[model samples]
Target: MESLEQKSSIARFLDNVFKLSENNTTVKTEILAGVTTFMTMAYILVVNANILGEAGMDKPAVFVATALSAFVGSLVMGLVANYPIACAPGMGLNAFFTYTVVIQMNHTWQFALCAVFIEGIIFILLTLTNVREAIIDCIPPLLKHAVTAGIGLFIAFIGMINTGLVKVGGAAVTLGSMRDPLVLLTVVGLIIAAILMSKNVKGAFLLAMIITSALGMVSGLITIPKGIISAVPSIEPVFMKAFSVSTSEIFSFDMVVVVFTFLFVNLFDTVGCLVGVASKGNLLNADGTLPRAKQALLADAIGTTAGAVLGVSTVSSYVESSAGISQGGRTGLTATTTGILFLASLFFAPIFTAIPAQATGPILILVGVLMASSVLQLNFSDPTDAIPAFLTFVMMPLSYSIANGIMFGMISYTILKLVTGQKEKVNKALIIISILFVCKFIFL
Candidate 1:
């Protein structure tokens, strides 16, 4: 049969390069894992466009841009990095680009894209010089664990806000009206997702999203799309706008703040995700480091710049890729497959975008549940590590900013180390970063 013959050649090549047997994964298993990963993170296409659209970018253009970025990024990750990590426009970074830069700061989206482009360039330079590895090693292990947990809270917070399960008051956030059917629908979806995830059902998160969205449609809560596919939108609207920003913007202090925040959040989040998912896939080396780490960093940097040029936000490795990693994907073929699917997704824009945010909300909450497990790595018995880590855990979601949490945690950690007579534990790189964060607050 055609299928059998195709699988034979593909399987042999994958087995030779990725050591399919050595990793206890086959071409078939890797393909399945890729699909699993794409299903979990598919919301990015719709969600990213909507988010960036708020900044006045064309929705359809951003939609196409988002998918293309993911396709190219994941392809690079597979071919160059040779890992199972999938890259896409990041969640928190997009919020920052939209709310912080374009809205609050009143900068053009073009300016924000310029900042991202510059940040990606810096990442590339750092990766080439091997500075990224040095900086990664400089971060305290406990702080890295805290970053994972903090991101969990951040994800859940985004989920709740999206579904109207939580509302922002003047001083604090309060619960939305549960009497409303929309709120109730969100609650039901979360419950379904939790139940499926607890049962270890494959594609539990994706299944929950599908079922919830279908229910929403039936109840008239979501609009049913008239068709599954749509004509590909022109990139001129977003692409032209992104490149219109002047290079002089790079010297602006506001741009510095935006770019630094992008770099900061992207760096730690990628580190935390890689550590967690690499370990799960058994893709780590004997020294507990990811192989071809520099190449991985370079691919991610390339993705960010390419994505911005293509009219999206910063690109980073997704923690949601862990869904596939846990599904026995230990090779680059998994990422390659995911990339191909992303390319195919360009044709099914209507179907992907028709998904309501409320449906995606539950998946974020469920994924947060998965990420929160990193807290188990905390050393609470030790005060120095515990105090800073705990602060990061609380402040990330509370402050609604990952960079804020990282900033405060690092400052507290350094101070606590000094006061507690553990100054030797403080590294030069961290001290420099703490100082820079302080400078950003003070000067900017």
Candidate 2:
């Protein structure tokens, strides 16, 4: 009788840990959804290490910090938002850190860290004042579609680089030879994704990824080095280090500009991602307010601050979370599950390191394709809408900045309406945003 009682107790504990409520479908769907989202954006966890590793940080330190920030940030986002979205160091911000701050500006990593923290604080203030909502509301609807599609293109570009289907050059980049096996595999993956999406397959992105990866392995396009599949042990806590910034550099106008730029990009990126994913999740009511927008924003801000303290770049929410919601995730449980997986990753860096970029690259490309479909929802009948949508969509991939694309689109829309005798259609909030965009570009 004692043995049976003990067994039942353990079972109950497991259920709670997994949050297996009466709705079994919800639990299973959430878990699968989280896992799928994790797979899509998992590269961020390692990309930071690669960037910092090139700049003299030890591999172990990078791994520890990356894993810790991702786990903590994701957990907070899950717990606070009660939404399944995951947070991590953003891709574009990391590029800014490595290329702009470190390389071009010749600043130390510590100063960049300071900038991240400062920006995070600013973001927190914006969220608290509900200023974020005003900024979001000011975005022309056409630009929103473009921003989404642009992100899709940006993500696809990353995947192409990872899979070696594209390479940078001195004056221009070049696409890889179509005959390469890896390239062929990526094409196959795209085809698979398209077919799955057309068929309305559940977890279509995940399914296409699995299929492509398996085919890549079988075709000898994906080579896994020995010991890459094995898991390492868990991580231990280290002493908290103080954040340091050199006053001489921190006070410089150039430094301030760089830091603010990072802050601005991350702020908009996070806001855009939240709007996109929340819309898909049905988290927002008829009113624009999301159920737990404050909680979600707080989590993102905290994550960015934590990431900076840990010697990385700004962290933010990912649009890839939409993949999970599209698969039926409706609660923070999915985010929690993804957080646990990220924590588990600290010990299992080898498992992640072992997976060739080619294996995962196809997955991101598939996600990008899925995300781009939102463009179709834009109201193209109105020239005001059509013009801005075209500008935003084209500028995203061309300018390589979603924020810039949005700003240009908005400015153009406002200008066109004013010149065409439709000035009454313009909102005061949008005019303010456009003015700010112009001033920031010219003066700042």
Candidate 3:
């Protein structure tokens, strides 16, 4: 009886903190959602470490940095913004960090880290000034809806690529072989998730992942981890390396270009994710802007900055949070749960890494299906709206870039509005943004 009272008291505390009732969610649902989100995006720890390792950094140190950055970012996001979004060193930006900044530019990895730090500071200032938030608000309602669907296609494509369900063919792309166990298991996982979803099962995404992982283990598809707990790696090698750059390197033109590229890509990636996920989660306000937009934007800004200090690439909101949101995560408690898990993963790396892409891929695909439904809310009668929205969603998968898709949509929207003599419909922020996009292509 005493234990039951303690449990009840804890439940009431959580309800008060997260406003569980107001969001139409419960403590159990939020926890499941957080776990689901973490499961889907956990691959980032290995991926980021490997990518940055190519730039001549310490692999073990980078791994520790990745986990710490994710923990810090997600914790701040949950406590400050009260949003369900999780943060990690983003995928594309890490590639650019190693390939473009470190390898091609002949800059030291430390220089690249410095650039990321600068870009993150700029992001914080931009967020404080509401520059980033205004850009989101200025986006046409149709385009906002398209962003949701676009990210849906983007992440689904990501899932397909991750699971070996899709491959590069002679031309653009092709399907994976049916004989491959990875591909076969992914298909079965998708079917299982679909059926669970159809039956309205709570925690369907999490359940699907567990079931698929179990199947893989039984079939000798995924290797079982040797053990669960490992010693936490020391981060001293990478920590604060971003501040080691020489003054000349910091002031160089290369730094400018690198910082600009990081800034540009991360800005849109974070914005698109926030807008898309918020839209899907019904967190957007009546005016199509997100409530607590400043706090939400600050979360990513802080993540990126802290990630740089921790010796990693820019950290931003992960679109995989949609998996949690789909599982009825409506408040910051979900993000807090994910944050705590990231912290715990530092010691349990092997166990977390043991979960393969085959298990998570289908969950991302299912999330794509949920987000893509926003397309139905769009008005297709006007060419001015329909054409841009079409490009926004279609180009995301084709170009393999959320930022590129948004760029095309914005530029075309501006052109169509001007050409159609509907200039009144375009706001000042939209025109400035369109011009900036053009400038990015020509200048960057």
Tell me, by TM-score, which candidate is best.
3
- What count of clashes does model 3 give? 0
Candidate 1 Cα outliers beyond 4 Å, as residue runs: 17-19, 26-29, 98-107, 240-261, 276-290, 326-329
291: Cα error in model 3, Å: 0.7
Over 249-367, each residue of candidate 3 has an lDDT whose tens digit, in order, gives: 99999999999999998898888899999999999999898888899999999999999999999999999999999999999999999998999999999889988999999999989
Error of 1 at 37 (Å): 3.6
> What is the alpha-carbon RMSD of candidate 3 to the true structure?
1.0
Pairwise TM-score winner, candidates 1 and 2: 1
What clash pairs does model 3 have? none
Candidates ranked, most accurate by TM-score first: 3, 1, 2
Computed on alpha carbons, the lDDT of every model, listed in order, comes to 0.81, 0.72, 0.93
Q: Which stretches of candidate 3 lie above 4 Å from their native place? A: none
The alpha-carbon lDDT assigned to residue 87 of candidate 3 equals: 96
Of the pair 1 and 3, which is ahead by lDDT?
3
Pitting candidate 1 against candidate 3, the one with the higher TM-score is 3
Best by lDDT: 3
